[model samples]
Target: MAASVQRLQKCAVSPTGKHTASVIFLHGSGDTGQGLRAWVRDVITPELAFSHIRVIYPTAPARPYTPMRGALSTVWFDRLKISQDCPEHLESLDSMCSTLGAVIEEELKAGVPKHRMIIGGFSMGGAMALHLACRYHPDVAGVYALSSFLNKDSIAFQAVEQRVAAGQSVPELFQCHGTKDDLVLHQWGEETWSVLRKAGMAATFHSIPGLYHQLSRPEMELLRSWILAKLPPDGP
Candidate 1:
């Protein structure tokens, strides 16, 4: 057992002189916020240069990988196995959800409108991003998930159902999964897509051929395009 930890740090880039949109990047397992910052840099920053968008990268708390030996990493929640669920994992997911809610509230306090904020991540971070977008009240502008899995067994489903019954549309979602991903099966992504579609959520699923459990250049490009499309023309 290891001591519990908190793994969220924020960075801001307001180079255009006006606060436009804000992107919060969540990192995957075994990585820190700084490690995943480059992914956003290559595509997001350049595309939004004129729009003056700001980026925030948040780290996940360190935790031992339950199914693997001699491994520890920062994770939004634990994935015990490819198709297994655990109560502890659910609790951790709840904690991350609360943390994200606080982050959104803080962004509002900082003057960023709900529609101007996008939440995205890779792998485990991607899972967390999907969870947050589906469950967050008032919804977010968009959600991007790269090489990640949706928590089919989590409490997010109930939350989303409640929101839908109230006549609220699910937030826009852009998901990218590598067909060759071995860690999180490609089928998981497809199944998740099916569930979202059945629930009447607006979701776009992209299956990248010949890619693995990591993001490639083209995938990053797709993400950039999606983000741009979700942003307001003048700056949001």
Candidate 2:
């Protein structure tokens, strides 16, 4: 295991003591797993309330973020900039993907089927989810990204293309972005969804009106519904 993966901090909620399915959500740039601890405890735990589901939030190790002039920050991967025009830093992104892949492998070893696990995140975390799910773990139940965008010519697209050629299953994607988002422009998210569909992935894009870069209750509620839909409880 890489040093970064070894140092990953994770927060989990498994109140029902059952692990029939799992949801691993990633946090945005500079945010740790504990950063989302409160939300998972207060909001997500109650909203989903599935006795068989387990939720895991993993924190990224602190590293030099190129967008911030190399200042250390907790980011899944480094990028030159957060825009469709800027080319993605594939080297760093691939490294982080491998690290995250290790995390997923742990879950699979724990008895969770690949198709019963869902992966998603917010902002940069969402971008990482896309890369991980699309390129590395295409058999996951589904993937969601909030207030996120992908650069043009992303490896994710290429990976999906190869999957299509091989007749392999590709997970569905649920992408939600606020129209008022300033940091990650809404247009960028929209374009990313468009490109994802063009790449032969089943993607749904939800536009939240009058919302900002931060998450909103309404968006999360919708996400909760999507989650339950994708990972319904097992039959008795």
Candidate 3:
């Protein structure tokens, strides 16, 4: 684990000065924020073209992951023990959500409106992003979760339901998962999409045939197009 970053304490700003929108992509466990930031360079092309879109890659807090037998890594939470359901560590979940909320608030205070901010991530990161978007932050542009699962019984569900009942437009979503993903089964993502849709969320799930616990180029292409549609460069 790297001792340099404790969390997404810093925002990775785009060189394009006149930014209109912002995105924060969380990396999977074991990956560093700096590494993911560099990797995203190819995904976000034409720097000048995307000048108005600021993208951030946040570093998760370093911690001992349960599944990894206490091995320390940059993780969103500590999975105490697993069963037929999602990770069950309410305290950890709450703390991680607070950390994520702080990041979102920072962006909001920095002049990025809630509607122009998009959040998503991969694996554990994806799970946290989905958790935040669906339960806590509902004013974002859209959520793009990849290879992740959601904790259905979270207390946040009530808030999400209330938001819908109030007729407020919540963040739209595009969830991507690999059919062959063994770590976080594709079914988990599907179930999450189903629950959100049943709750009246504008969300969709895409299942890539042969992808596993990793990202695929095709998946990125889909995400890119979806993002472009959500926040067009010409849009104000």
- Best candidate, TM-score: 2
Q: Each prediction's TM-score against the native?
A: 0.85, 0.92, 0.85
- Candidate 3 lDDT by residue in tens digits, 1-236: 23332346544757365777888888887887776666555554532135677778888877888888999888887776543265457677777777777777777898888888889998778877877887778888988888877765655455567788998777887999988887446776788778777777888889998998777778887887887788776665
- Candidate 2 clash total? 0
Top model number, lDDT: 2
Task: Rank candidates by TM-score, best first.
Answer: 2, 3, 1
| Backbone clash count, each prediction separately | 1, 0, 0
Better of 2 and 3 by lDDT: 2
Candidate 1 accuracy as lDDT: 0.72
In order of lDDT, best first, we have: 2, 3, 1
TM-score of 3: 0.85
How accurate locally, in lDDT, is each candidate? Answer: 0.72, 0.84, 0.75
RMSD of each: 3.8, 2.2, 4.1
